[model samples]
Structure formats: C-alpha cells, structure tokens
Target: MPRTNRNGADTKFRAFSDQTRLRILHLLRAGELCVNDLVEIINVPQPTASRHLAYLRRSELVITRKKGSWTYYALAPAANAFHKTLLECLGQCFDEVPEIQKDARRASKLKQQGGCCPR
Candidate 1:
C-alpha cells in the first residue's frame, strides 16, 4: 500500500476506522492511561491493545513514557487538535440523534461506576 500523506483526510479517517483504536483514543483524551487500562476498557487482549498503541505512537497521535514497569500513553497535543475538532462535531451529531444520546449517557454512567456492561 502507498504511504498516506501525513496531513491527508484519508490518513485521519483510516486512524479512526478501528473501533478499538477509536475507543482508546477517546479514553486517552480524558487522561494519560496505561496499556492495561486501555486493555480493560477496550476489552481486548494486552497484545491487541499494545498493537494499536504502537500504531498510534507511530502516527504521532499518542506519546508514551515509561514509569517503572508501566508505560503510560497520552494524546499528543499537536495530534489531538484535529481529533478534538472531529469529536466535537460528532458530539453535535450525537446530540441531534436521540438514540445516540441515550447510549452515550448509559456508557458514561458505566464508565463512572466502574462497570463494563457486556457489549
């Protein structure tokens, strides 16, 4: 496959195509989190979470720092500008869609309460 242009919409859309990856990015927006946290929240194996993290790191969307045995990941400030804008637009669409609004509320409650409602 040809390499995607760094500033192209195709690259951005490709990055957000994977549901797991998108969830990981969303969670990272809230705060820096370790691979384990992403694995838990994304309900994926550690290796899978790590793979996505690696891809995001390579794309410059996420940055990581080693702390003891753990490596924590966070959204890179420069990378997040586009994502933040895109998510804000999506947020508006979700607000306009009642079903999406309900789902978002339910998911937020689950996250706040430390529960993973089986997908």
Candidate 2:
C-alpha cells in the first residue's frame, strides 16, 4: 500500500509556483473552461495546457468534468480550511497583477467571440 502524505502545503505551493499554472488559475477564477479555451486564451499548445492542468489536478487545486470529447476544469470547491483560505488569498493577490489581468481580458474576449466551446 502506498502512503498518503498528510502535509499538502508543499504540493499546493508547488502548484502555484509556475507562471502557466498561475495563468490557468487566474483564467479559471472567472469560471470553468474547456481545455481548448485555455489553450486558445493562453496561446499555448493543447498539450502544454493539458500538462499544467494535470499538475493543478494532482495538487487538488482544481476539479474536472468531461463533456463528450472536451474536458472542463474549474477551481476545486474548498476541500478544507487551509485550501479555502489559500484560494481566497490567491484570488486577491493575483487579481491585481498586470499579466493576470491581461489574461483575464483575453479570456473574456475569447468567450465573447465564441472562439471555442461556448458557455
């Protein structure tokens, strides 16, 4: 049997350490989005987006749903006290960053244009 690590602070911190992951989390702050939408908005390749998303999933920072061939991801509902507060802090801190703001604008425009899977 494999041992489950009790301390997830390191895992959560690692999840927030990458620029791509941070961008993804900022994008997801608006709402759930498909992998294609993330790829388009972030201007990265499909595999790149998937790879970062996988990292987020492993960190238990995001949740997923599959519709047909598309997979959608959103911030995971607060799993516990620590994650809840951390997510709240992340939202507040990233909301003011210029790069994150730009990414949100791009994502908003893409959604408005129906660039990918429509909401």
Score every model by TM-score.
0.66, 0.90
lDDT of 2 by residue, 1-119 (tens): 76655338878888889999999987887889998899888889999999999989988888999888778899998888998887888888888888888888899899889768845
Q: How displaced is residue 101 in candidate 1, in Å?
A: 9.8
lDDT of 1 by residue, 82-109 (tens): 7667656443433545544444454465
Give the Cα lDDT of each candidate: 0.66, 0.86
Residue 54 of model 2 has an lDDT of 92
- Segments of candidate 2 deviating more than 4 angstroms: 1-7
Model 1, position 61, has a per-residue lDDT of 73
Task: Single out the weakest 10-residue window by summed lDDT for candidate 1.
Answer: 91-100
Q: Which is the leading candidate under lDDT?
A: 2
Candidate achieving the largest TM-score:
2
Residue 56 of model 2, lDDT score: 93
